[model samples]
Target chain A: MAKPDLIIIGAGPAGMAAAATAANGGLKVHLLDDQPAAGGQVYRNITRNQDRLTHLGPEYTKGIPLADALDHPNITHVAGAAVWRIDDTPTVWYSLHGKSHAIHADHVLIATGAQERPVPFAGWTLPGVMPAGAAQILMKSSDLLPKDAVLAGSGPLLYLIAVQMIEAGQPPVAMVETQTPQMMMRAVRHLPRALLDRQQIFKGLAMLRKIRAARIPRYTAAHSFKAQIQDDLLDFEFTSKGETHHLKCALVLSHQGIIPATHLTRSAGIPHKWHKAQQCWHPDHDTEGRTARPGLWVAGDSAGILGADAARAQGVITANAIICAVRGLRPSIASHVNAHAINHRNRAQAIRAFLDAAYAVPPEINTPPDDTILCRCEEITAGTIRQAIHDGATELRHLKTATRIGMGPCQGRQCDLSLTHMLAAQTQRPIATVGMPRARSPVRPVSLGEIAALEQTD
Target chain B: MMTDSRFFRRENGTYDTVCLQIDGVQTHARATDTVAAALLAFGPAPTRTTGISQSPRTPFCMMGACFDCLVTIDGRPNQQACMITVQDGMCITHQAGFRPLEEPHDG
Candidate 1:
C-alpha cells in the first residue's frame, strides 16, 4: 500500500473532521479507529442507532454527517483497527482481523479523544459500580439501560446520562451530586461568558428541569461516597449536607468528568504538560495542534479536555496547517479557517472554565481513603501507593517500579490520572512536578500470536 | 430475573439475528450486537470475576478502556467482550479468576 500523505489515528469528531478537511484539500488521508464505526465514544453508533435517536438527543444525530463525510473518495477509512505502536519513523503498526499491518505517513494526527477520569473509592472494583460514561455507551450502542441505577459524582455528563435515561423510560433511582454550593458560587462568576452559548445553557437548564419533574431523588453536596456489594446488590452510601444517606441499588454509576487520553501521544515520545485548571496532562502543542515533533500533530480532547464541537473546529484548523506544510504553502494560506476555528474554540473555552470549576473532580475522589483500591487491574490500594511514596518513590515511574501500580493490561488508562493527583497530594508537590508514568508501546495490549504472525507475513 | 427485552429493542429498523452459545446455553442476538450487549440482554448477571478478589464483575465501560468485561471466547482467554461483535455459533464463557499462563517453548 502506498503511504498516505496524512494519517489520522481516531475516527471521532476531531479525526473525521481532519480527514474530511485534508482530503478535500487534495491530500490522501487514512483514518483508523478501534471501534467498528466512525463515531468515537460521544457519537458512537450514530448510523445504527437511528431507532433510538430521540432518546440519544441532537448531540448524537450531528455525528451522522461526520460519519458520512468519512466516506470521501480521497480518504481511506479503516475500522476495528487497534493501533499498538507508533514509531519515530512516523510508521503506525496496528492489528486488525488477527493480523498486524504497518503504514508510513508524512504527517500523523493524534486525536484519540478522552476517557472518564477514574474515580476510585471503597468498593469501586465491585461488580455493580461503574463510570457513568460507561452506562451512556451501553445506551448509545445497544440501548441497554440499568434497571435500578443511581448516578453519582459531579459533572455535566452525570446529569446528561440521567436525562437520557429518563428519555429511555428508565430514570435512575436517584442522583448524588458531589459539587458543593461554594463551587457553584465560584462558577457563577463565569456564567456571563458561558451564557454566550445560550443554546447549551438552556439545554442544561431543561435537563435539570426534567430531572426535577421526574422526581429522581437529587442530593446536593454529596461527599465521601462509597459503594459495597451486599447480596448481589450495590449498597451505596454518601454524606449529603451533614446527613449520611444510604441506598440499595442494582447499579452505581459514577463520573468525575473526562481527561485527555494522552497514552498514544506520550508513547510516541511527545512532550506533555499538566494543565493546572483542567487537572490533567495534555500534549504540548501549538494553537494549530503542531507538537514539538516535526511531523506529528495533536488535536481534539487528546491535546486537552475540549468538547466535541471544539474538537471539530480544532480538527479543521490542524488539517489546514498540515495542508500548508505538505504543499509548501505559507501559513497565511489557511488563515481564514484558522481565524474561524480560533473564534469558535475561544467561545467553547469560555464555558469550559465554568464547567471545570462547577464540576471539578473532588480532591477526596482523586485521593481516596487509604484502603481504597487504586489500580483495578493490579488491585493496588491507595495505602500501598502512599506507602510507596513514603519509601521515596517520588515520581510516577518510581512508584511503578516500587509498587507495580500501573503495570497492568489497561496500561494505566484507568488509574494514571488519579495516581498523579494522589502522588502530588501525598508528597506535597505540584501535580506537574509529580509527572505521569512513562508511556511505552504497544500502547494497547496485542496478543503474542498476532506479533508472531507479523514476522511471518513480513 | 427480568430480561432486557422489554427495556431494549429496535423500534423502527430490522437487523438479522444470529444464534450464539453463552456459558453452554444457546442464545439469539442481533448481528450488530456486541458480545457484551448480547450477554447483557440475556440478564444482568456478572460477566466475569476479578483476578485478585474473585469477586463478580460486569461490563463497566462498554468501551475498550475498562477490562472488567473480559471473557473467554472460542477458547481465547481474556478477550474484551465489549470490543468484539457477536457472530453465529460463537462460544463464550464467563471467565472466573485468572487463566494460568502457558509456558513458552523454543521456536
Candidate 2:
C-alpha cells in the first residue's frame, strides 16, 4: 500500500472531518479508529446506530454525514486499528487483527478524543458500577440499555442518558447529581456567551425537560456518593439536601464529565497544559490545532474538552492548516477564522465555558477519601497515594513507584486526575504543578505478539 | 418499550444477534458488539476477577481506559473484552486474577 500524506489517529468527528478536509485538498488520508466503526466516543457507531437509536435525538444522528464522508477516494478508513504509539520516526504504529503495522504520513493528527473522568469513591469498583457514559457506549454500539440503573455524576451527559433511557421506555430509577444549583448559578456568568450557541443551549434544556417530563427522580447537591451490592442489586447511598438517602437499583452509572484521552499524545512526548475549568490536562495546541511538535496536530476533545460540534469544526480547521502546509502556503487560519466551521467551533467553545463552570468536578470527587481505590488497575487505594505524597513523592513517577499507581495497563488514564489532585492537595500545590504522569508507549495494551510483530516487519 | 433486564438488549438494532459463550453459558450479543458489551448485556455479573486482590470486576469504563474488562476469550487469557469485537461461536471465560504469565498469544 502506498503511504498517505496525512494519517489521522481516530475516526471520531474530529478525525473523520480532518480526513475529508485533507482528502478534498488533494491529500491521500488514512484514518484509523479502534472501534469496529467510525464515530468516536460521542457519535460512536453512528453509521450503524443512527437508525437504531432515533431516541438518542438528532444530535446523535448528526454524525451520519461525517461517517459517510469517508468514502472520498483519497480517504482510507481503517477500523479496529488500535494505535498504540507514534515513534520519533513519525511512524504511527497500530495493532490490527493481532498484527502491528506502521504508517508513515507527512503530517499526523491525533484525535484520540475523550474519556469519562474516573471518579474514585467508596464501592466505585463494585461489579455493578460503571461510568454512566459506558452504558451509553454499550447502547450506541451494542444496542443495549441499562435498566433500573441510578445515574450519578455531574454533567449534562448524565441527563442525556436518562432521557435516552426514558425514550426507550426504561428510565433510570433515579439521578443523584453532584452539581448543585449554586454551581449552575455560578455558571450563569457565562450565559451571554453560552447563548451565542442557542441551539446547543436549547438542546441541553430539552434533555432536562425530557428527564423532568419522564419524572425520573432527581437528587441534587448530592455528595458522599457510594454503592455496594445488596439483594442482587446495587444499593446507592449519598447525602443530598443535608439529608442522607439510599436507593437500591440494578446498576450504578457514574460520570463526572470527560477529559481528553491523552495517552498517545503524552506517550509521543507532546507537551500538555492543564485546563483549570475542565480540571484536566490537554495537549498544548494553537487556535488552528497545531501542536508543539512540528508537522503533528491535535484537534477535537483530545486537545481539550470541547464538545462534538466544536470537535468537528476543529477538525476542519486542523485539516485546512495541514493542507496549507502541504501546499507551501502561509498555513495561517487568519483568512478563514470567520468560516462556517470556525464560527461553529467558537460558538460551541463559548457554551463549554458555562459547562466547565457548572459541572466542574466537585472537590470531593477529585480528592477521594483515603479508603477509595484511586487506581482501579492496580487496586491501589487513595490512602496509599496520600502516604506516598506525605513521603515527599512529588512527581507522578514517584507516586507510581511508591504506590504502584499508573503502573498497570491503563498507564494512568484512570488514576492521573485523582493522583494529581491528591498530590497537589497534600503538598499544598496546584494540580498542574503536581503534573500528569509521563505516559509511555502502547497507550492501550497491545499483546506481546503484537509488539513482536513490529520487529518482523523490519 | 424497554425490557426488565438490567443490561437489557433493545430490539430493532442494526445487527442481528451473534452468540458467544460467557463462562460456558450460551449468550447472544449483537454481531457488532464488543466482548465487553457482550458481557455487560450478560452482566452486572463479575466478568473477571482481579489479579491482585482476587476481587471480582466488570467492564467499568467500556472504553479502553479501565482494564477491568479483561477476560479470557477463546482460550486466550487477558484479552480486553472492550477492544475486540464479538464473533459468533467465540468462547469467553473469566480471567481468574492475572493470567498465568506464560500463556501463549496470537498476533
Candidate 3:
C-alpha cells in the first residue's frame, strides 16, 4: 500500500477535523480507529445497520458533517485498525482483524481521546454498576436503557446522560451528583468565559432545566456511599448537605472526568505533561498541538479534555501548523483561517477552563475514606496501597507491579488514571512523570480458541 | 433490539439453591446467574473495592470494560464478576491492594 503523507491515529472529532483540514490543505490523509465508526465516545455511532440518528440523538448527528469528508479521495478511513506500536524509526504499526499493517509518514497526529476515571467502591462488582460512558454507549448503539437506574458522579456528562434517558422516555429514578460547592466556586472564575457563548452555557443549563422539569431530583454535594444488592435492585446510601439518604435503583452510572489517552503517545515515546487541575496526563504541545517530537502533533482531549468545539479548532490549528512545517513557511490561507480559529479556540477555552475548575477531582477521589477499597480485582483496598506506599513503593510503575493495580482486565483503562492521580498527589510527583502502561495488540482480550483460530489463518 | 443471545447462556441449576462465600461471609448465590447477577440478587450492591484510600466502589459498567467488578474468585484475583458464571462452592473474596497477589500475571 502507498504510504500517505500524513497519518491520523484516531477517527474521532479531532482526527476527523484534522483529516478534513489536512486534506483540504492538499495533504494525503489516512484516518484510522479501532471501532468501525469514526465518531469517538461522545458521538458513538450504532454499528448494526440501524440509524445512529435515532440511537445517539442530535449532538451525535452533528458529526455527520465530518463523516461526509470520508468521501474525499485523499482521505482513506481505515476502520477497525488498532495502532499498537510506533517503531523507533517512527513507522506506525497497527493490527486489525488479526493482521498487521504499517505506514511510514512524514507527520502523525495523535487524536486518540480520553477514557473514563474509575471510582472504585464496595459493591462495584455487582451486576448493575457501569460507567456513565458505557451507559451512553449502550444507549447510542442499542437504543436501550438500564431499566430503572440511578446516576451518580461528578461532571456535565452525568447530567447530560440523565437528561438523555429522560428524553429517551426512560428517565432514571434520580440523579446523584458529587459536585461540591467549593468546586462550583472554583468554576465561577471562568464565568466570564462561560458567559461568552450563552448558547453553549444554555445548552448545559437546558439539560439541567429539563432534569428539574421532569422533577428528577438533582442531588449536588452527594456521594454514592455504599451499595447493596437487594432483590435484583441496587440499594444505595448517599450523603447530601450533611444528611444521609437511601434509595433503590436497578443501575448506577458514574465518572469524574476524562484523561488524555496516553497509551499510543506513551508507546511512541512521546513526552507527557501532568495537569493537576485536570488530574490527568496530557501530551506536551505548542499552541498548534506539536509535541516535543518533530512530525508529531496532538489535539483535543488526547492532549487534554477541551470539549468538542475546542477539539475542532485545535484540530484545524494543528493541521495548519503541519502545513506550515511541510511548506517551511506559513501558508497564505493561514491568515484567512487564523482569526476564526482563534475566536473558536478562545470561546471553547473559556467554557473548558470553567469545566476544568468546576469538575476538579473531588477530595473523596484522592483519599477515599479508609473503608473504601482501591483494587476490586484482587479485593485490594486503599489501606493496602497506602501500606505498600509506606513500605517504600515510591513510583507508580513499582506500586502497580507490587500491588497488581493496573494488571487487571480492562487493561487498566479504568483505574490507571485514578491511581495516577492519587499517587501523584500523595508523592508530589507530576502525573506526566508517571509512566502510562502500554496497550498490547488484541487490545480487547480474546479467548485462547480465538487466538488459535487466528494463528491458523496466518 | 436484538441482543446477541450467544452472549447470554442458560444454566439448568436452581436459581434459589446454593451457598457462596463473598469475602469470608457465607452469602447465597445462584448457579443460574453470573457472579455479579447473583451478588445483585443479594443485599450489597457493590461486590468490589477501590485501591486508593480504599473507597467503596460498585460496578458502574457491567459490560466488563469498567474493571470495577474485580473480585477474587475461588483462588483467582481481579476476576471480572460480570463475565464469569456462578457455580456452587465459589469462594469470592474482596480485592484490597494496589497489586493484589491473586492477580493473573502475563508478565
Candidate 4:
C-alpha cells in the first residue's frame, strides 16, 4: 500500500475526487472502497459496465474520467476493502482480502456515501420484495433487470430507476407513489429556488416525460400498502384516496429516500444533528467538509444527501482544505481553489430543499403497522416494539435492550431511523430529543478470526 | 416462497463469464457479478431464511448495508455476498440462522 498522508474512506464521488485532488496537491492518498471498483453506488460499475449501460444515461456513463482520476502514483485505490472502524488518532481499521489492518494517516476523510432509508411495510422482508435502489444496483453491476417490477414509496430515485428501466426496454409494471397531491402543492413554493439549477430540474422533467411516454400506471398517495408472495409474483395491495389497488408483479421495489451512511461517523463520536428537512441524522460538518474533530473530515452524501455533483465538489473542496492544513499552505488559497466548487455545492443543496419538501417521507412510513417488522435481523415486529415501548421501554436504549431492535448485523442501518421515530411517536415526545443507537465496534460485520489476525501498520 | 429467480440478465455484454457452484449446482455467472448478483440472476428467491423466525429473505439492499444477502463462501460464515466478487469455482450456499461461534485457540 502507498504510504498515505491522507486516507479517504470510500471510493464514491467524494472520496475519488478528494484522492485525486489531494494527490495532485502533493499528498500521497490511500482510497479504500468496499465495492470491487471505484464507482460507488451512483456510478457503480461505471468503470466496467459503461459500454453496455447506455440505457443508464449520460451522467452515469460520464463518471469514468473521474473514476480514472485515481490512476496516479500518489493515490492507492484499494477495492474490496471493508472499513469496519476508525479512531481519534485517525487510524483506519479495515479488512482487505481477509486480513485486518490499522493504518495511520494525518487526516482521514469519510466519504462512505449514502444508503437507502429503510421504511418497513408489512411483508417487506419477504423474498421477492426489495429496495428500488437494489434493482438499480442489480442493473448497474450485474446487467440484470426485473421486467415486472413495481416501484413503491416516493423519491427521485424511483423516477430515475423507472426511466432507466424504460430505456432498458423492460418497463416497470406500475409505480405506487406515497407522496400525496398536497405534498406536491406544498413543494411548489420552493420550485423557483429549485429551478435556479435549471439543468437538474430539466433532467427530472425529461425523465418524467420519458416515463409518461412509456405509459406505465402511477398511483399517488398510496397507503396501507403490503407485499406478499402470490404464486410466482409479489402481491402488493395499497390504498389511495380510499381506493384500494392491487398489483401482482415479479418483484416489488420500495424506497422512501436516502440517508447518510452514518455508522462510522456516529461510532467515531462525531457530533451529529437531526436534519429536520431530510428527517435523518446528518453528521455535522463545515462547508469545507471539516468535522468538529480536527484531522477527521467528512464529505459527500455520507455527510448529507447532496447528490453526486455536489459530492464531487465537496470532495475537491475537502481535499483543498486538507492540503491547506497538511502542507501549511494558506487557508485563503484553499478557499480560493474551492470557490467554484462551493458555488456548485450551494446550488445543489438549494435544489434539495424542493425535494425534501415534496417527498418529505410520509409520517406513516416511520410508524409502520403493528404487524410490520422493525428489525430485520431479529425479526422483531412493530407490535413487539410498541409493546416494549408500552412496557416501559420508553427510551431508545431501553427499547433496544428490551426488544433487541438496533442490535443486528446491519447495525440499525435498516431500522434505527424508524425505531427512533416509533419510540418518540408512541411516547408522544419530540423526535429530535429521543437520541440514537450508541457507537458499536464493527459497523460492518467481521468474523472473530479476522479480528484476532489484525495487524497494525505504521 | 418463490424458488425461481425473478431477475433476468441481459446478454449484450462483452464481459467474460465465470463458473461457480451455488448449493452444489454448477452455475455460470458473468465475471463482473457479485455473489449476491449471481444468486439473484440464477439461484432462488428467499435465498436464505431469517436466523430468528426462519422467515424467508432475499438480498434487500444490493449495496452492503443490508445483511439479508449474508451467505457462506469458501468455508467462511456470515459473509456479505454483495461485498465480494463472484470467482470461478467458488462455493456459495444459503446461510440459515446464525453461524455457531467457533472457540478461540490458544495463541
Candidate 5:
C-alpha cells in the first residue's frame, strides 16, 4: 500500500469534514475511526438508524451528507480501526481486525472527539447506573430506551437526552439537575451574546419546553445524588431546595458535562494547559488548528470543548492550512469556503461562555465525598485518593504510584478528569500545576494475540 | 424474563434477525445490534462482575470509554461488548472475578 499524503484520526464531524476538504484539493486522505461506521459519537449510526430519524433530531441528520462526502475517491475510509500509537516519525500505527498496521503521512490531524465528564458518586458502579451519553448511544444506535429511567446531574446534554427520550415516547421519570441559582445568575452576563445565535437559543428553549410539557418532574439545585440497589430495584436520592427526596427506578442516567478526550494528544507529547472556565486540560493550538508541533494538527472538541458545528468549521480551516503548506501557496490566501466556516465557527462559539457558566460541573460531582469509588477498575475510593495525597503523593503520577488510581484497563480515561480535580482540591494546588497523568500507548488495551499477528513491513 | 420495552424493531425496515447464545440461553437480535444492546434486550441482569470487588456491573458507557461492559465471547475473555457486533451462533458468558493471565511459554 502506498503512503497517503495526509492521515486523519477519528471519523467524527471534524475528521470527516477535514478528509473531504483535503481530498477535494488533490490530497490522498486516509480517515480512520474506531466505530463500525463513519459517524462519530455525535452523528453515530446516522446512515444505519434510518428508522428513528425523528427521534435523533436535526443535529444528527446533518451528518448524513458528511458521511456521504467521505466516499470521495481520494479519501480511503477505514472503520473499526483502533489507533494505539503515534510517534515523532509522524507515523501512525493501528490495530484492525486483529492485525496491526502502520502508515506514514506528511501530515496527521487528531480530530478525536469528546466524552462525557465522569461524575463519580455513591453507588455509581452499580449495574443500573450509566452516563447519559451512554444511554443516548443505545437509543440512537440500537433503539434501546431506558425504562423507568431517572435523569440526573447537569449540562445541555442532560436536557437534550431528556427531550430526545420524550420524543421517543419513553421520557424519564424525572430530571435531577445540579446547576445552582448562582450559576444561572453568573450566566446572565453572557446572555446577550448567547441570544445572537438564535437557532441554538430557540433549540434549547424548545427542548426545555418539551420536557415541561411532558411533565417530567424536574428538581433544580439538586445535590448529594446517590443510587442504591434495594429489593432488587435501583433507588435514587438527592437533596433539592433543602429537602431530601427519594425515588425508585430501574435505571439512573447521569451527566455533568463533556471534556476533550486528550489521551491520544497527551500520549503524543503535545503541550496542554488547564482551561479554567471549562475545568479541563485542552491541547494548545492556534485558530487554524496547527499545534506547537510541526506536521500535526488538532481540530474539534479534542482540541477543546467546541460543539459539532464549530468542529466542522475548524476542520475546514485546518484542511485549508494543510493544503496551503503542501502546495507552497501563501497562507494569506483565504477562500470563500474558509471565510464562511470561520464566521459560522465564531457565531457558534459565541455562546460558550454562557453555557460554561450556566452548566459547570459542580465541585461535589468533580470531587465526590469520601466513600465514593473514584476508580472503578481498581475499586479505589475518594478517601483512598485523599489519603494518598496526605501521604505525600502530590502529583497525579505520584498518586498513581501510591494507590494505582489510573492503572486499570480503562487506562485513566474514566478517572483522569475527576482525579485531577480531586488532586488539586486535596493538595491546595492549581489544577495546571497538579497536572494529569501522561498518556501512554497502547492507549486502548490491545490483546497480545493481535500484536503478535502484526506482519513486519516497511 | 424481563420484557425489552426500551427497544423495538421498526417493522418497515429491512434488517435481519440473528440468534445468539447468552449464558447458554438462546436469544434473537437484529443483525445491526451490538453485543451490549443484545444483552440489554435479553434481560436486566448484570453483564459481568468486577475483577476485584466481585460487584455486579453492567454497560456504563456503551460508547467504549467505560470498560464495565466487558464479557467473555467465543472463549475470549475481556472483550468489550459495546464495541463489537453480535454474530449468529456466538457464545457469550458473563465475566466473573479476575480473568487469568495467559501462561508464558518458552520461545
Candidate 6:
C-alpha cells in the first residue's frame, strides 16, 4: 500500500476538518470510514440530493463543506472501509468491501468519533428495542420512523429526537426521561461556556421550547421499568419516586451517554484514562492529540465525547500538531495570536463544559421495577444484580467478573456505563474513580463466516 | 415496516430458546436473540436496572457495546445481555447496586 503523510480515521466533522486542513497545507492525506459516505453518524448524508431532510426535523447538518472537502486532489477518501486493527507501527489494517488493505502513514489522526452509550434493561433485546442512535440511523439512512414510538432515556438527544419526531409528524407516544431537575440545575455551571456558541444555545433552547409547545409528556427522574413486545407494540414499565407504573408503546428510544470509540485504540494497546466526568473511556494524550505511542495519534470522540464543535477544533489542532511533528517545523507562534487559536480554544472549552453537564446519568436510575429485567442477553434481573453486589462485588470490573456484565459479545458496550454509575452511587465515590473495562474484537457479533471472509485477501 | 427479525431462523434443534430469569421471573430466550429480545417477547419494556437510583433498565442497543444491558447470571454480575448467547436454565438477574467483587480486589 502506498503511504500517505497523514491518515485520518473517520470522515465526521473532526476527520473532515483535519483532512481538509492537512491536505490544503500540502500533506498527502487519506480519509477512511466504514460508511458509504463521508459524513459520520450525526451529519450522515442520506441521499445525493442535499434537499432531502430527516425525521429528525430540519436539516441542521449542512454537508456542503464536507462535500467540498472531498473534492480536494491531495485527499483520498476511502468509504465503506471497516478498519479492524491498528498496529503501533502506525499502520491501519481494514477491509474495503471484503478486500484486505492497509495504509501506512507518517502521522495519523484518529477522529473515529463517539458512539451512543447503551443503558440495558428487560425486553431491550426484543425485536423493537433499539438505541436512540439506531433510530437516528434509520432516519438518516432510510427516512424510516419507528411506528408509534416512545422516546425515553436522558440527555440532549432525547429532546432533540422528540422535536424531530414532532416536526416529522411522527411524534412519539410519550417521552420518558431520567434527567432530574437537579441534574439540569447542576448543569447550569456550564452556562458561561454555552454562551460562546450563541447559535447552538439558541438552537438547543429552541428545540426545548418546541418540545414544551408540542406538549410531549416528559417524565424527568422517571425510569423505564420494563420494555417488552406485546401485541406487536413496545410496552414500557416505568418507575419514579417509589412508585411503579407501566406504559404501552410501539418503540422505546433510550440513551445514557456516549463514549469514545476506543476499540481500535485499545486493541492497539493504547493506554487510556477513565474520564469519570464524562463517564466513559478516553485515550490518554497530550495537548496535541498524539497518543502515548508515536505516530498513533487520536483526536475527537475517539479520545472523548466533546460534541461536534469540540471535535472539529480538536481535529484541526491535532492535524496541525501532527503536521508540525512530522515535518519538523515549529508551530507558528503568530497563529496562536490569530482568530484560529481563540476560536478553537473557545469552542473546545464550551463543548467540553456542555459535555460535562450533558452526560450525567441520573443518580436514581438503577431502581428498576420488581418485574423489570436487567440483562437482555442473559435475561438477568435487577434482583439478581443486587444479590451479586450484596454478595460483595464493589467495583464494575469485579461486578463484571462476578456477574459477566461486560464480557458479552458487544464488549460491554451496552451496559457498562450504567453499571459504573450504579457502582459509583453504591460506593459513594466520584464517578471518575470507576474503572472502564477494556473493549475487544470483533467489535460487533459478526459470525465466524464473516471473520473468515475478512481474513481472506483479495 | 422492516423488522430485522423477519429473517430469523433456528440454528439448532428445539427452536433454540435461550432460557433466563428476569428479576427472578423465569424466562426462555433464543440463542441468537438477546435477553432483551426474550424479555420483550415475554412482555416488558426493559431488562436491566438504572445506574444511580436503581430504576428499571432495558436494551438501548441490541449490540453488546452499549453497556445499557448489564445483568447478573448464575451469581455473576455485570453481564451484557446484548452480547451473550441465551442458554436454557440460565439464571439471570438485574444489576441495580454497587455489585461487590466475588474475589479479592487489588484496586
Candidate 5, TM-score of its B chain: 0.83
Compose the digit string of candidate 1's lDDT tens values, residues A166-187: 9888899999999998999888
The residue-by-residue lDDT of candidate 4 on A1-458, one tens digit each, is: 54589999999889998999999999989898998898899989888775567888888975798898899989888888989898878888998887888989989999999999997999888887889999999999888987688999999999999998999899999999999888888899999999879988898899999999999999988989898877767799999889998899888899899999999999888899899889999789988888888789999999999889889989999999999999898888889888888998888777898999899899878998899998999888989998988888878899888888878888888999999999889899888889777867687777678898888887
- lDDT tens digits by residue: candidate 5, A222-308: 999889988777889999999999989888999988899888889888899899989988899988888877788999999999899
Could you give the candidate ranking by DockQ, starting with the highest? 4, 2, 5, 1, 3, 6
Can you give the lDDT of residue A256 in candidate 5?
Answer: 84
Question: Between candidates 3 and 4, which one is better according to DockQ?
Answer: 4
Model 4 chain A worst lDDT run, 10 consecutive residues: A439-448
| DockQ, all models | 0.49, 0.61, 0.12, 0.66, 0.54, 0.08
- If chain B of candidate 3 is superposed on the true chain B, what is its TM-score? 0.68
In candidate 2 the C-alpha lDDT for residue A272 amounts to: 94
Ranking by TM-score: 4, 5, 2, 1, 3, 6
Better structure of 1 and 4 per DockQ? 4
lDDT of 1 by residue, B1-107 (tens): 42333135534466688999989989888788799888877766787887887877777777888787899888778889999999999999999888657824221
Better TM-score candidate (1, 2): 2
- Candidate 1 CAPRI grade: acceptable
Poorest 10 consecutive residues by lDDT, candidate 6 chain A:
A449-458
Task: Quote the positional error of residue A431 for candidate 3 in Å.
Answer: 5.7
Q: Please give me the DockQ of candidate 4 compared with the native complex.
A: 0.66
Q: How far is A191's C-alpha from truth in model 1 (Å)?
A: 2.1
lDDT of 1: 0.85
TM-score of chain B of each: 0.85, 0.86, 0.68, 0.87, 0.83, 0.66
Candidate 6 accuracy as TM-score = 0.74
- For candidate 5, the C-alpha RMSD (Å) to the true structure equals 2.0
Model 6 docking grade: incorrect
Give model 3's DockQ, 2 decimals.
Answer: 0.12
